[model samples]
Every structure is written in structure tokens, then in C-alpha cells.
Target: MGIIKLTNIRVYAYHGCLVEEGKIGSDYRVDVSVTANLQPSATSDHLKDTVDYVLVNQIVKEEMAIRSKLLEQVCKRIIKRIFNEIDIAEEASVEVSKINPPIGGNVEMVTIAMTLHRSDYSDPTQL
Candidate 1:
């Protein structure tokens, strides 16, 4: 019933439909929201009981850095990787945006989002 949000994580990478996009690169702003029971961390004041946001950021960054033509695919990769890799996160939503896309029109960015839940997920460490 509680949450910890990681927001405005800007990643500079090459991911677009155009060939120039993959060659020149662009900016991606991602917002990640993780939901989990934080009662243990709140009560014990221990970092171990909660998710480490730094690790999450690294994961997101790594996923975004991978060159992909579609933001939708990149967003899905982020969601699936978090669900399969991160253990402490019970639920997560990844919102990835393409800044100043080459649409040749008036548009700031295009957003692609995906949400995933690890309710029945197995621990990767154990596997």
C-alpha cells in the first residue's frame, strides 16, 4: 500500500525510428514508480528492508541505453527487466519519453509507458 517513486531520470541515448536517431542520439526522460510494502523499512529504519533506488536507476539506464527503434519496445524492456531482475519491487510503472522528436511538427515529446507487477515472480538470485 506504500510507494517510492523515482522520477525525471533523464537518459541520453540513441533510440528512434530514424537512422539518424541511432547515429546521433537523443534524450530520454523516464519516470519510474515502484510500489511495495515498506512497513519493515519504515519501522526498522534499515535500508536492506527496502528497495535501493540507485540500483533501479542503473537498471533503467542500462535498458534505455540499448538502441531500439521504438520507444514502446524500449519501455517494455525496462518493465520486463525490472519484473524479472529486481526483487524488492512488487509493482512498477515505467514512463519513457522521447524529447524533441523529428516529427517535423509542433511536438515536445512522445511518451511510451508500461506497468508490471511481480506478484508471482520468482527471485532471479535464487535461479
Candidate 2:
């Protein structure tokens, strides 16, 4: 098994509970990692045999563009999409960070993370 990671995907999106946050928007950083059997692609030297990083990036960008009230929700959606879309991926995780958030204290960002396995979804059809 091997892991493919897409790190520090920068996006500007409107995702927050505050009314101003929805209107003004904020910068966000997203990271996604997936574990899959890489031996096939490694030996075949073909893109089709491996987890496509391009598709992963596109998923992140598309999901981030949608509005959400919390980072946790964003993380869930990201992980769900990864597992559902990438059939080769056995497991996946996502981290979403809200840069320069509106929280009352000094903080670089507030992040929420979630990990999911293909088996975690009771229904195979859902995966």
C-alpha cells in the first residue's frame, strides 16, 4: 500500500456561521491524503493505474467553493468525496483550516480533521 497526499491547497471561500463571514469570505487551506495500492501504477508507469492527484485537487476546489457553517462539515464532505470518487483509495483523510478567523483570540487558524475508511460506510453503494 502507498499514500498520495495533496497538501496546502489554498482557496478563498465563504464558510462561516457569521453573517459577515458569509459576505466577506476568508482564506482557507485544505490538505487531503489517500492510501491505495500503488504497486500497479508503479510497475505499469501509467496514470490510470494510480490515484490521480489532479482529480483529488479538483474535488477539493469544487467542495471548498460551497458554503458551510463549520470546518468540521467541510472536512466531512471532503473525506466523503475522496472515498466515493476514488475507488482505489482504501482510506482517506481531510484537514481544513480557516486562516485568520474571527475568533476573539490571537490565532493563525482553526482546523478540523476527519478520517474515513471505505468500510466505514455501511452501505457499499454509498461508497
Candidate 3:
């Protein structure tokens, strides 16, 4: 198995629980890391061996731009879409973070992350 990561992808969008948060919108950053079996690409030297990060970014941005009440739902939707859309990735680890969220505490950020693997594939972590 091999890994390809897209780090600190920035986006501006409306996502939050508060009326002001959803109404005004804010900056968000996503860190997406995907692991796929690399043997095919390594031997064939073909583009089919890996997921295209560029296309993945567009998918992520489109998902984030849509307003959602909770970050968890947003994260889940992205993961699901990735699994269905990106064929090269066998496993995915997605992190979506909001900067300076509208919270009472003095927190600087809040985020939701999920890891999904194709049910048919072997665990990449064991690789």
C-alpha cells in the first residue's frame, strides 16, 4: 500500500450551528489523506494507479460550499462521495476544520475527521 495526501486545502464557506455562523460563513481547511494499493501503478506506470488530488479537491470544495448544520454531516458526506466517486482510493482519512468557530470557549478551531476503507480491501495500516 502507498499513501497520497492533500494537506491544508483552504475554502471559504457557510458551515456551523449558529444562525450567524451559517449566515455569515467562514474559512475552512481540509486535510485529506488516501491510501491505495500501489503495486499496479508501480509496475504499469499508469495514471490509473492513483487517485487524482486535483479532482478530489473540486469534490471537497463543492461539498464544503453547501451549508450544513453540523460538521459531522459535512465530513460524512465528503467521505461517502469520495468512496463512490474516486475509484483509485482504497482507504481515506478526511479531516475538515473550521477556524475560529463560534463557540463560547476560547478554542481556535473545531474539526471532524473520519477514516473509511473499502470493505473488500485489506487494511492498509497493517501494510
Candidate 4:
């Protein structure tokens, strides 16, 4: 097993509970970690044998494009997509940060994180 990490993906998006937040949007940073079997890729050195980081980034970008009321929901969506679409992924962790949150006080950001294993995820097709 091996861990693949993609960190500090910056995006400007509109995701918040407040009305103004959605109109103005904010900067966000996303981090993703995936655990999978890497022996095949490690030896064969083929992109097809392992999780593709570029595809992961595209997924993140696509998810971020959708507006949501909460960071927790966004984080979950990313985790679920990675686990379901990436066949080699055994586990996935996602972190989302809203930079310079509008909390009335001096705050740099607010973040939400979630982790899930492939076995723990419900089959989407059954739903």
C-alpha cells in the first residue's frame, strides 16, 4: 500500500451560508490524500497502474465549481467521488479551507475535513 497526496490546491469559489458570500466568493485551498496499492506502478512505472494525480485535480476542480452551503458537504462529495471513481483507491481524505472567512473577527480561515475507506462507502448504484 502507498499514500498519494495532493495538497494546497487553490481555488476561488462561492460556498457559504451567507448571502453575500455566494455573491462575492472566497479563496479556498483543498488537500487530498489517497491510499492505494502501489506495487504495480512502483515497478512497472506506468500511469495506468496507479492513481492519476491530474485526474484527481480535475475532480477537485469540478467539485469546487458546484456551490454548496457548507464545507463539510463539499469535503464529503470530493471524498466520495475519489473513492468511487478511482478503482485503486482503498481510502481517501479531503480537506477544504475557506480563506479569510467573514466571521466578524480576525480569522484567517475555516476548514472541514473527512476521511473514508472504500469498504465503508455505500454503493452508489444501489441508491
Candidate 5:
């Protein structure tokens, strides 16, 4: 088993409870960590045999484009997408952060994070 981590993925997206926040958008940083068996790729040295970081990043980007009201929901979507799309990932964790969020005070950012195991996910297609 091994862990693959992607950090500080900067994306400008409109995701917040405030209506104006969605219109103007804000900077977001996402971090993801995936755990899976790496023995196959470790020996084969083939991208096909392992989780692709590029694909992971693309998934995050795609999800970020969709507007959401809460960071927790964003984190949930990211984790679920990774587990569903990336067959090699046995477990996944994600952190979603909004930079300089408008909270009526000086705040650098607000972040929400979540982790899930593959078994915990129920495929939407199946439902």
C-alpha cells in the first residue's frame, strides 16, 4: 500500500453561501491524498498501473468549476469522485479552502476536509 498526495492546487471558483461570492468568485486551494496498493506500478513503472496525478488534478478542477454553498460539500464531492473514478484508490482524503473569505473580518482562509474509504461509497449509478 502507498499514498499519493497532491497539494496546493489553486483554482479560482465561485463557491460560497453568499450570493455575491459566487458572482465574483474566490481563490481556492485543494489538497488530495489517495491510498492504494502501489506494488504493481512500483515494479512495472507504468502509468496505467498506478493512480494518475494528472487525472486527479483534472477531477478536482472539474468539481471546482461547479458552484457550491459549502466547503464541506465540495470536499465530499472531491473525495467521492476520486474513489469512484480512480479504481486503484482504496481510500481518499481531500481539503478544500477558500482564500480571503468574506466573513466580515480579516481572515486568510476557511477550510473543510473529509476522508472516505472505497467501501463507504455507494455508487450513484447503482442507486
Candidate 6:
């Protein structure tokens, strides 16, 4: 198995419980990683045979654009989209970080991370 990682995807998005936060928005960083079989692509030298980072990046950007109250929600959407859009992906993990959150203390960032296996979605109760 091989992994494809897209890290430090920066975006400014409105995602928070506070009204001020929704209006003012916050800076966010997203990291996505996927595991898949790369041997086919390695031998064939073809993009179709492996998990594509471009699609992964696009999924992260699109999901981040949508406003959600929690980082976990955002991460779930990103993972779901990656699995739906990328057939070769066996597993996907997403980390969403809110930079300089409004937690009333000196904090660099708050991040929520989640991982999903392709089979996890088969039963909605697991979610």
C-alpha cells in the first residue's frame, strides 16, 4: 500500500458556534491522507491507477468552503467525499485546524482529526 498526503491546505472560512466567529470567519489549515494500492500505477505510469492528490486537494477545498459548527463535521465531509470520488482509496484521514481560535486563552490552534475506512460507511449506524 502507498499513501498520498496533502498537507497544510490553508483557507479562510466561517465555522464556529459564536455569531461573531461566523461573520468574521477564521483561518483554517487542513491535512488529508489516503492509503491505496500504488503498484499498478507504479508499473503502468498512469494517474488513473493510483489515488490522485489533485482530487483530494479539491475535496478539502470544497468541503472547507461550507460553514459548519464543528471541525469534526468538516472532517467527516472531507473524508466522505474522498471515498466517494476516489475509487482507489482504501482509507482516508482528515485533520482540520482552526488557527487562533476564540477560546479566551493563548492558543495557537485547535484541531479535530478523524479517520474512515471504506467499509465504515456501509453501515450508517457506525457514524
- Using TM-score, give the best candidate's number: 4
* Tens digits of lDDT, candidate 1, 26-104: 8879999888888888998988888778878998899988998888888777767766665667888889998888899
Q: Please give the distance, in angstroms, between residue 40's alpha carbon in candidate 2 and its true position after superposition.
A: 0.7
* lDDT (10s digit) by residue, model 4, range 1-127: 9999999999999999999989999999999999999999999999999999999999999999999999998988888788778899999999999999999999998889898888774783321
Global lDDT of each candidate: 0.82, 0.90, 0.82, 0.91, 0.89, 0.89
Model 4 pairs whose backbones collide = none
| Clashes per model (N, Cα, C within 3 A) | 0, 0, 0, 0, 0, 0
**TM-scores, one per candidate:** 0.88, 0.94, 0.87, 0.95, 0.93, 0.94
Compute the lDDT for candidate 5. Answer: 0.89
lDDT of 5 by residue, 57-78 (tens): 9999999999999888888788
In candidate 5 the C-alpha lDDT for residue 32 amounts to 96
lDDT of 4: 0.91
Better of 3 and 4 by lDDT: 4
User: Which residue pairs show collisions in model 5?
Assistant: none
**Runs with alpha carbons beyond 4 Å of true place in candidate 3:** 120-127
Predicted structure 1: lDDT: 0.82
lDDT of 6 by residue, 1-127 (tens): 9999898999999999999988999999999889998999999999889988888888888899999998889998888788778888889999999999999999999999999898767843344
- Could you tell me which 10 consecutive residues in candidate 3 have the lowest summed lDDT? 118-127
* Model 3 C-alpha lDDT versus the unseen true structure: 0.82
* Tens-digit lDDT string for candidate 3 (1-127): 8888899999999987788887789999899888888788889887766677887898899999889988887877777777777777778888999998877788888889988787743543322
